[model samples]
Target chain A: MSEPSGLESLYRELILDHYRRPRGKDLAPTFDAESFQVNPVCGDEVRLRVKLGAASSDELGGTDILGQVTWTGTGCSISQASTSVMCELVRGEDLGRVAELEAAFGRLMHSRGLGLESEADEDALGDAIAFEGVAKYPARVKCALLGWMALKDALAKAVAGDSSPAPGPKG
Target chain B: MTGLSPETVTSPTNAHGLCGPGGLPDLGAPREPITPQEVERIRRDFPILARKVRSGHELIYLDTAATAQRPSCVMDAMTWFANNNYAAVNRGAHLLGEESTEAFEDARARVARFFGATPSEIVFTSGTTAALNLIALSLGELAQGEPPASSAVPHICPGDRIVVTQAEHHANLVPWQRLAARTGAELAWIDAGPDGRLNLESLAALIDSRTRVLAFTHASNVTGAVTDVARLVEAARSVGALTVLDAAQSAPHLPVDFRALGVDLAAISAHKMLGPNGIGALYGRREVLEQLPPVFTGGSMVEIVTMTEATFCPPPGRFEAGTQPVTEAIGWAAALDYLSHLGMDRLAEREAKLTARLLDAVTGIPGVRLLGPADPADRLGVVALDIEGVHPHDAGQYLDDRGIAVRVGHHCAQPIHRALGVRASTRASVGLYNTEAEIDAFAEALANVRPYFGATQ
Candidate 1:
């Protein structure tokens, strides 16, 4: 039998807490940018809406500080919790830091559950580090990255000055 | 897709232990169910089942519906063929080529024999998907315009109708949809009832004189419910429509006799039946096959080639284009021989018992909802279930952690899952070699899933 800790590493209490009462699990009536993504293999989906507070003409999506990042979707714990954690991490933060954290999280997921080398990166990941065990499962990596993909897409739409929300989910 | 039959769900217990695969007295088959000893002996043929996974837990394989594990004999047969008779079949005048061609033809003969059909009726393809696509593509070509003088392919006129079922896998459904779109034919379907069974009441309206084709599955991959092929075939025959059966799931667990089923065309996969991958067969009635237009045209399948045009070979040869998976064919023939030796009737009985046990175990869990029929007697051992308040991925991971491999997804049949009110599901299917104990272990693990994920609510 696998050690209880093996599963625990992936389904951390913090992660479970987020999954049980997900953060930003609601659609905003109005948002500057919105994107929906579905992991077709398992059908874990997330639609994220980001409201950028200010645009300082930073083409890199850096000057726009996300005033709010809300989402709504149905999926597994890993995907739902990852979305919750991502929403919490990016809210009130500049798109530049969000991008850096997204990059850092991507590295963490690619770590194959061994975690990252630098303590700085791990610290930056916060509760998101709990998903380290998910990387060992290549199939679940998309679950952890679902929210990030939607965020990236929404941010791209915002940066491109496209204010329209997609009518439905996309894979 | 049905309302929860929780009343049928019992305590997470092994009802099969009291009377397992030893013998299925109630089954109408004259053959006996494979005994526990027989199951053990069968397991010896498949070495992968003995391997450990995820922190050294013994592998409890319950995902046979996705793809069956190949026995050592199958691999050995392919290897032996590769070593001794590996050559371009029907090409060189060399001894190896002659032997290779003979072996390839022999494989076709064996597959045909197993399905109670003649060698001329079997057309080799990559898999069932390819087989169905071949049929649809040929029909599409015929719909477009006239083919060679020899071709007698069915025409799908602009207003003609093509009827399928709601429970068809995308492989079976999409090709027909595309065929309908290309031919300007209206695509209709028999809806699945709340119980996940085909609502045959809609069949009268959907299938009419204008119906050029009626394609459906012999057994649903999602629901595990075996279709009443006779009724469907009778209806199609009444309208003089071409009937295409997707036998991918049925050919594995059921003793699928194409002649007995009376379908004009059928597709089957070998990998799902403990044979090698990348090899399958399309079975057509001898006359039907003779008339069907070839989907693929190339070197091996032609009769004579000219600078501008080439006449095609008859039936099976006409359909098999280019180089074939000769080694895989040999392996699949060996697999058929293995199944033949065991008797498909006996194996089917054994599988029925296991399905009963599996259904009993999975549906017993509080929140688990079966995606198929509750009765195991008429269904295959393929069970796809949804655990409420818990996603299939999480459920699948929990099972995987315990070394119980299961399929977790829409399983390439998204429409059925949607009809069942779920985006995805976890399926635990059984093969002939599976035991009652494994089903218990799966159930025990599955029972804890709700609490483990805190999804009891």
Candidate 2:
């Protein structure tokens, strides 16, 4: 098969821009809860830190939930950009709602099920949709998923409150 | 730009079928008897050489260390065998089966002769990794008191030493490591010099009376530095240690005579020498092989079997436990024949000239640091280099943009890279068909790498 051109949709300028300057790339000074995640296939790593605050949501009765989420890690552009978009979408949401968001993101990236319908609230995942082209390149799918997988692990750790640190990148 | 267009001038094949009776085209002939023209004709025999990548750019394959392109003769031989003589060897009573067995044995005989050993001593393996693993497991069995009934063999104790080199590829290193872990034996390593060549002086110290096996590579897959097998064999012999030579790289490029080298056992791969993948051969001295217990046992290897007990065949068959890759063996034998026809001496000479050209070109390029011997005489046509301020992966990507293929990363010899004080380096390895023109093109591409990366050369 012919190699995909560098200027094509996969290597789009926006992806390179995100790779060069990733947003939401910082750790909370004192995270109420945090988790470390890694993509074992490749050596991409990410640490997801969440801060729970006593802010009530109109949709739910007065109850404290995770108020902010931030991430810091090293990985390829797809992974980093995906995590950036993920952090932006899930921030200020209740901790109980994380499972649904994770499942939705997994379906989109892995191409296993239907994607979420376009809505004004879904604008946070703008850069991540750029990676829909990556599903075609099976060898590179892992590269795109490195960050999101790390987030999954980190979230699990944060829920457990036993976060030391994840294993370092393997050779 | 002349009366004849550039396209016409470039069409050397159309003007004179290079492989036709007259001989190859003269594109700066070499001092070797096999001129540059002859090499081009030889290159034409390998159909894969004509392939293009990245639009119209010709494929400049330099990853022979990973796998070599097969010549038409090898491919044709394998095709003929599968189409005409396909049958189960050794076990069948039919005519086709017997014919297939004879052909298979004939291939074994050819391999034995290629390495200057008896047919009985050659064991067909999946590849060099399997051969090395077989040797390691067999030795482990012997060390653990799983010996044949006829003779009692010495068992390895906790204090016994298995000597290996730090420069060894993981194939040579990992099995021994596992063996040491299992047997409680100490694994001693011989260090490589700053130039990446094996330090034979240190190897002498490493092999003492307690050393039961001395394993080392005939050539470093990463550095391309050939080892002094004579010195190593002598050192191991003085300590009464059986020697295992990893000839995966050397056998493909040079004239390897296992009998003359006097190693107890040697392993080589077929794919590295322009043959099909999934087949390799292990050469063991007849007496030594007879003494060693089989690593695997089943099917064709058994002499006779009862519910309670079984008798095994000797040497090659004893080690060969399963149905073999018959087509692959035939292909490898054909590859050997092609190499023989070219004459190893002539092939080596051609490669030496190309190695010199590559060495000169890379050395002249600023910011490029060669990993092994700066002089081409001390090395094969494999050059591993680090371009200053540019990671090997980025450098490899730049070369890839130009249709030039090279291996990046640690090249699966992490210890060597660690010893050399680098995370990874890009490598360009040559095969029989590589030309000086390709080397020049490689150098030109490499020259553009540092600048492209915005690194000062």
Candidate with maximal DockQ: 1
Model 1: per-residue Cα lDDT over B379-405, one tens digit each? 898899989888898889888888999
Best by TM-score: 1
For candidate 1, the per-residue lDDT at B178 reads 98
Model 2, first chain, TM-score of 0.72
Task: lDDT for model 1, please.
Answer: 0.84
Question: What are the per-residue Cα lDDT tens digits for candidate 2 across B348-414?
Answer: 8878888889989999988999999877778888789988866575566557656788987777788
Candidate 2: which pairs clash? A35-A154, A36-A154
Q: By summed lDDT, which 10 consecutive residues of candidate 1 chain B come out lowest? A: B15-24
